[model samples]
Target: MSSTAAFYLLSTLGGYLVTSFLLLKYPTLLHQRKKQRFLSKHISHRGGAGENLENTMAAFQHPPGLPVYGIFQARTMEWIAIPFSRGVISAVTIGTDMLELDCHITKDEQVVVSHDENLKRSTGINVNISDLKYCELPPYLGKLDVSFQKACQCEGKDNRIPLLKEVFEAFPNTPINIDIKVNNNLLIKKVSELVKQYRREHITVWGNASYEIVEKCYKENSEIPILFSLQRVLLILGLFFTGLLPFVPIREQFFEIPMPSIILKLKEPHTMSRSQKFLIWLSDILLMRKALFDHLTARGIQVYIWVLNEEQEYKRAFDLGATGVMTDYPTKLKDFLHNFSE
Candidate 1:
């Protein structure tokens, strides 16, 4: 090959490598396991009794002994730090000890908080967020249509598509749990980088997918913990791993051993059929929390569940033993925890 031809080839390969490197470091995953190992110190030998960030020690709101702290899904109308911060404030004031938030990557590669994949579903814009620039992303957040009163009332305020750094600065010491609703597998490295940037080891990265992405996040960002989502786990076990659960994969010496920090979500009822129920009788007996409690806690792993409603359910989960429950109504969960003690 001629010298000019070789130069072009080298340049092309170099560009690809640079792009790949940038994506992996978004949340800024540093290999500082010693600094950010939140679980190792807190979780009981069985992965329970993890403490709270703001008010109580654990998610359980009532004092130290009563279990169950509320894990809430907060929305950011402005993409600014205040919106995310306010959610934590609200959760705290209303008796909540813990809170949850959703994360996604913008076209410019900034990590932003958003519950929906497309802006259209929540804001009526027919575009994937991955296609828009940071400035372009802010225009839609101008007027949120949510009727929930709390978020809707704050519609006219200035909230930008927040950079992860903003959130870190606002809730520096406060503990938070983040849900990775988007399937941008490439963002794992970026998430690690940004996480290391603020040195916010208190935050936990969550997903439903299996061992692969979770392990990547944990390995890269040694300080931050991870949580697994229901769909992600099912996909890993049924199709990818061929019925073998997390430990089996790890024991087999697969590099994809399950991340010890994160917990698995169980399949919901609607997803199950009668025929399948008999085959997986054990699953039919346990809802996501029950199953996660039985599976993870027993193995000394921490687990988290999703959107549980009702006061009775909260008491039952704590009674049965769960590392955490992701709730849409943190205010309600807080109220429930308060009354249980009174």
Candidate 2:
């Protein structure tokens, strides 16, 4: 209540405001630019689920069940009788800069590429991925529904579940974003070992939204880049709003997040309660700040908005200074990016 105390308080508040504004406008002032090994502006969600069966070999490479002839088999009449399949396009061929997929641990400690822990939705089998060995895994349903796009189904010739190592061998050069769906130490260890074995430490990004999982992943292999966990993201939003973001040292390299508006659209306003809709709208307003995005980019962090399927959503993400847009429809996104002027 003293005049001197009030004066000091006002001075401190003014100084903090000025510092926050300057840092928001120019984040490089405090943080050194981080060196990124791989940059992607077009990320395929679930290996372009809308274009092919999600996370299947057909989604990422050649159709499964195709036989390779050995040098001796080349002389066999069976090689000549085999028919060649056409019109099967892979996600890499569709011009996706990065592939976004999830991982789960099989019963035999193998890492498989899948989004859900349960196989009912994708494979139509009521079993946990961890309960089955890699070979015991069932084939995917003839027609699986796309997660992001409701009521839309995608069918492909290759319905077999693929091992993570197989995907690495198939697409060694492509950058991949791996989401650890569960808090399994063995799964994390296996994925880390695979990354090291494949020498893809620079090109692979792996983490889970759970802080515990992310920490374990980093401890397993600190060289590989990590996506922000849910706790870190919440802390980041808090710091950004409190004008203390610049003072903080961000360790994560990628900020992969969902666009709130797109999420709201997916939830369908008619189906949401008034309070749910309002919270989503409020999150949209708070998280969509271009200044926050620009500051993160300036700090050498790539911001990727995920699961955006439509062209308009892609345009919105790019317009808001997103580093990339992850979508279920890679072909559609490729076309949009091709025709995009900016």
Top candidate, metric lDDT: 2
Model 1 Cα lDDT, one tens digit per residue, 51-156: 2221111222222222233343222211111122122232344443344545678777877765555877445678877888766873334334322112222122
Instruction: Name the candidate that leads on TM-score.
Output: 2
Write down the TM-score of every candidate.
0.54, 0.91
Computed on alpha carbons, the lDDT of every model, listed in order, comes to 0.44, 0.84
lDDT for 250 (candidate 1): 19
Q: Report the alpha-carbon TM-score of model 1 versus the true structure.
A: 0.54
Model 2: weakest 10-residue lDDT segment is: 68-77
